[model samples]
Target: MNSLKIVSLVFFVRSMEQIPCPCCGERLNVIGSRRRKYLTSQSLPQVVVIRRLRCCRCGRIHHELPDFLVPYKRYAGEAIEPVVANELPLSVAVDESTITRWRQWFAERAEHFAGCLESIRIRFGYGFVGGPSDLSLSVLQRIWHYVGDAPAWLARVVRTVANTNQWVHTRSAFCPSWQGYTIML
Candidate 1:
């Protein structure tokens, strides 16, 4: 089943009736809890119990993640910030290959994120202003402008884009192991 990630530190503390379903706009109900393990900014391991909420109207399950965590990423948001900002001498808990992969992932989605943020700005009736050629940096700058230079910037971006239904995610190919197999669409 496909599940949505809700980034909120006080998700559990808040009343379930107050939390609306991101997909269907229905009230959410507390379903269960799951333990998530991730590395801290210093590379130390930590575990957190996150709540699972269900939307009765849509029958969709949502994972409530803390602001420090990023969906599908094992590293803390703070640890990944330096890499996204292009800081030198990558130093973290993970291997070099992992860091390389993170860099590549951000590179692939940076432009899309910039475009989404731009669209949001325009949707709010803001005047159209030209963006920099370096859209990735521009996106980062805009995010900073919106949310300040907080350590949880990445998580905040994830949450924002996700709420707007513009979050980009990697998916498997249509034909995962199609060896000369063709089908009509």
Candidate 2:
């Protein structure tokens, strides 16, 4: 996630060689590309072509997923924000069961997410902004004050968490306050 560049499909397609592989710490070679169908909040679903790259050293394949696209999920995280914030999402692309899983996942990780965000604010010399604390807010709304009205607000929020700590993808917080347990969300 740290090495990922939030670039256009055209830019990624044209410059796949410049990107490094997340798996093996090797320069990536363009192996091929594939089209994926994803949904937005309104209108028919859109299809975008994403490039597939191989690690020149480890020979592992990696899909160059866009920041907007949630890995292994059909609907963008942005598309699901409304549903997470309020009522159920009425869409054919996503199912209630999937949304249930998302809610449960968020509930499980909300505290960790909040503490990380608070750390980010502290690191930047900005203490808490007098908004909803992690315990008082839903995971989706935890950082609303920080995110503000930015376009693609979901992406920016996620980018903040992703940029804050690279190991969040596969490891649990290594704080003494946290009981030693692996978090693989």
TM-score per prediction, in order, is 0.74, 0.54
Q: Could you tell me the C-alpha RMSD of candidate 2 in Å? A: 10.5
Q: What lDDT does candidate 1 reach at residue 108?
A: 78
Question: Any runs in candidate 2 off by more than 4 Å, and if so which?
Answer: 1-17, 23-25, 87-98, 109-151, 157-185
Task: Please name the candidate that would achieve the greatest lDDT relative to the true structure.
Answer: 1
- Model 1 regions lying over 4 Å from their true place: 1-17, 89-91, 126-139, 142-150, 177-185
Name the 10 consecutive residues with the lowest summed lDDT in model 1: 8-17
User: In candidate 2, residue 36 scores what lDDT?
Assistant: 78
Per-residue lDDT tens digits for candidate 2, residues 12-94, read: 32443477655556788778998877776653476778888788998977776677866555777777655555545354355
TM-score of 2: 0.54
Residue 36, model 1, lDDT = 83
